[model samples]
Target: MRAILAPLWNNAYLLMTLTCLFWAGNSVIGRAARDLVPPVGLAFWRWVLAFTLLIGVAWPYLKRDREILLKQWRWVVALGALGVGAFNTLLYSGLQYTTAINALLMQSAQPPLIMLMAFFLFRDRTGPVQIVGVLLSLVGVLVIVAGGDIDVLIHLRLNPGDAIILGAMLLWVLYSVLLRFRPPVHPLSFLAATFGIAILFITPFYVMELMAGRRIVPVAESFATIAYVGIFPSLLAYAFFNRGVELLGPGRAGVFLNLMPVFGSLLAIALLGERFTTAHAVGIGLIGIGLLLTRKA
Candidate 1:
């Protein structure tokens, strides 16, 4: 793996950074999309479209590896639940009740929390430096989620948005560990299958909502939002992320995703008119330092 990845790390780094930015933009999209589409409807259709694209693009491989994918059906379903079903669903749902800044801060906790969960769940070894770095990054995450207020964190009264974001974190952690464990048949083929199968999983919930008559009323603007989610975050971002994981390996690639919150916060300010404050600056510095310390030296 090292020999294969060494030559591609540079390109992977660039691609992953772009993935982070895309995800940050996704947050903005979700926020802007509120009220225009039902959260569940947006989540459901994005995957439906993504599934279509992946099927077309990976049709040859999908046919070739049909047996292997069939054999790994459980993993595919598991990954689909965590990666597509849970993550995107929670994101859209949270955006309904929370500010984009709140959502981004909560999502930012993924890297450190994933490391901590891996250590405990899998008995992975952790050094003092790593533990400290994780803790430091976690503190930053807490600060951001608390809206730059230590008092709110101290009170332990986290906002509902934070809870939703935490759910997204847990979903991804499970996805990460699952990827490490019963990996799909082939990396690229697996990614394609994982995404291609998402629509099937999300369809039931969408159907229920539609039966209840709460589906987003289709309009030109609504179509644009769904199309944006399909192409940008679901298709392009996943492609970038998979290429990064293939090139840099999952560990390094995971750490690079830390940039998502930073980018999200900045974009929130620029696009959403969120105020930039001292606490945000401090949190950024701490998370940056933590990532630097955790990086392979």
Candidate 2:
């Protein structure tokens, strides 16, 4: 098991790419299920299921790392609140009103945001090459967001949903930046602790959502959405992203998020029968070049 997993665990690029793939799928699915699953309710259950699935495997690591975890409880709580609790809930909430295109456009801001936060908060410096790379990727994102037409951006309007998604993006940026300070513990131990904290943090909001008459519709599609979100985006994506950040640093790791829109576009074509266009090819090419440049930096 160690031998098979070690190679993957060491491959930061692969981890981050997979992370974006899962997250792209997450955005698509979240949008599709918005009517079926309420935001806070979806978030609450997503963490609940992730925690349930993780705790069993993490128990031994938790026991072994109890002292370290307890010592670093503050970081655990902060990360849980920002990354698992607020970000995801707000994302789902925002998706309720926004088109997936708008959401992906919002997501494109993450790399620069993460870079800026890292610089301001920690004095982390970004090189010129990285800056150029980020700009290229941003253009790629714009091409995709605008559906190959620049005029679409001119006519784009921001609504409450866009603001909500921006707020979520900011929270995730903070989470990614602060992950540098995470305690030295087994990945499983950290994830388990944070997952538990996320559940605790989200409980009241979930209850309030219930009180407000925003209940999840009980249906097969809702269950399937919950199940997929619980396992892929919640469990695997977070783990892979955290490790990728650990290996590559927040600035570099964040550049990979540019791929989310790229993958999201392809996923749409494959799943929704959307047409593949020249813009997608050009945008994907630019994003690929940007990633390679960032990697070199």
What Cα-based lDDT does every candidate model obtain?
A: 0.72, 0.94
Q: List the candidates' TM-scores in order.
A: 0.83, 0.99
- Residue 49's lDDT in candidate 1: 83
lDDT by residue (tens digit), candidate 2, 1-297: 999999999999999999999999999999989899998899999999999999999999999999998898899999999999999999999999998888888899999999999999999999999999999999999998788997898988888999999999999999999999899999999999999999999999998998999998999999999999999999999999999999999999999999999999999999999999999998999999999999999
RMSD (Cα, Å) of model 2: 0.8
The regions of model 1 sitting more than 4 angstroms off are 1-12, 142-148, 152-156, 159-164, 182-186, 243-253
Candidate maximizing lDDT: 2
Residue 276 lDDT, candidate 2, scale 0-100:
94
The residue pairs that clash in candidate 1, if any, are none
Full-model lDDT, candidate 1: 0.72
Worst 10 residues of 2 by lDDT: 144-153
Q: How many residue pairs clash per model?
A: 0, 0
